[model samples]
Target: MEEEECLSHSSPSTDNSLELRLQRVTAENIKTVRILVSSIFPVSYSDKFYQECMNNELTGVVIRNGEAIAIVAVKPENFETGRVLYIRSFGVHPRHREAGLGSFLMDFVDEKGKLLKLPHAMLHVQTSNKTAIEFYKNRGFNVDCLVPQYYQRCSPPDAFIMRKPFH
Candidate 1:
């Protein structure tokens, strides 16, 4: 795996920062998030798909300094009568990578899930995306299953379903 340079952005501040708040996706932020997705992932959906996510209340964004640097879309599922938060899409802007922003955003979700009594958090990642795989693993995610050709539409890559039990 090739190591990419860690990108950094101005740290989020409370005084001048544009309220780095987490809110249900709005029409304005949905467009911005779509662009973000397209930039990070090879395959991304149309504007309507983003709008659907916003309408479904599955999307979230972190606004900092009046810019959306991180975003995630979660799909809550009932598995064995226990609620699991499936991280559908998650990304931080390239310029914001390795700035503790990704961990901060994920920690925010994990804290929220714990407060809501969600048992575990789940997500899928391309097998060849070693950087992302290692990042999640370092954060304590363990692989539960593998899917072949999972990203056929996006890339010719296999996928791994990972989960972390939030005790």
Candidate 2:
């Protein structure tokens, strides 16, 4: 929560009717990001947990009017993969899925990784979430491995460790 600078990023909507604006996310934006993320994956956690995630993570969010409808969080070089940008969390509000928001944020992350000299983007997704798996696959991500019990807090706690490398 050092510098809370807001930026506007425009992307296409689901209907391709209007442009959706995105911006940098800080600790103050965690509440809305959490809500968006929880809508996709509900986990019991506190503000401190999310605050830590946003402390230095590269997070982008789409706010409509006054509410966040999408969010993507990333951690730089904090993984076993050297020079990798790990996608800690990503989600679009249930009501806003299929909109170009997810793709836009993902493209932003790719650009972000390259900017930081990181070429890999990694994330863990529950195996049960077929929609998400397909979404990642369509975006050029591939399953690198299976993380058993990765989602221990949830039922069917297995996850696929997916990774996409920048060219």
Candidate 3:
């Protein structure tokens, strides 16, 4: 991730035209979200995984402009016997990034997790993805653990599992 100059933070209401809406993802949007994921990650979306997201067993959000511009998927997990949410895929369109959209989506997820009473929100980031690591860390995520050779096919960086506790 490139270290571009930080943009000014804007209030949610200030960017009403560039709305960030969170809804239960449907089958139709899964493909588009998959495209979004593929654009950011090295993994390809499998048919079964897309189906699971559309089935509502997994939670997702679509940030759109009459079409999916960005998407996030979370799988609920039982951590420490408490409900936890792991962000499975999160990506903003390359064209729309650096305009506060990522932060908006993240804020939306944080609110949703709080409402769901999740103990913490977790995600894994490649060590080479400095921009994503900085973004999460700035949003209160702490590096919880490191896994070696996590994405062996794509890059040679260790995986950093970061988590942000809600309570």
Model 1, span 29-125: residue lDDT tens: 5556666788887766666667666745456666544466787677677765367987877888898787666776676657656766888898879
Candidate 1 TM-score over all chains jointly: 0.77
Candidate 3 per-residue lDDT over residues 1-167, each given as its tens digit: 22212222224533556544555566556556766777777767677777776646245455354456666677777765366788877877787778777787777667668778888999889888889999999999999889898876767657998999876
Number of the top-ranking candidate, with lDDT as the measure:
2
lDDT of 2 by residue, 1-167 (tens): 34445444455666666676666666566666667767767555566657765644376677775567887777775666666888877888888888677888888788778878888888889888899999999998999999898875887898899999888
* RMSD for each of the candidates: 8.0, 3.3, 7.6
lDDT of 2: 0.75
TM-score of each: 0.77, 0.83, 0.79
Please list the residue runs of candidate 3 whose C-alpha ends up more than 4 Å from where it truly belongs after superposition.
1-16, 55-58, 63-66, 79-83
Worst 10 residues of 2 by lDDT: 1-10
- Greater TM-score among 2 and 3 belongs to 2
What TM-score would candidate 2 get against the native?
0.83
The order of the candidates by TM-score, greatest first, is 2, 3, 1
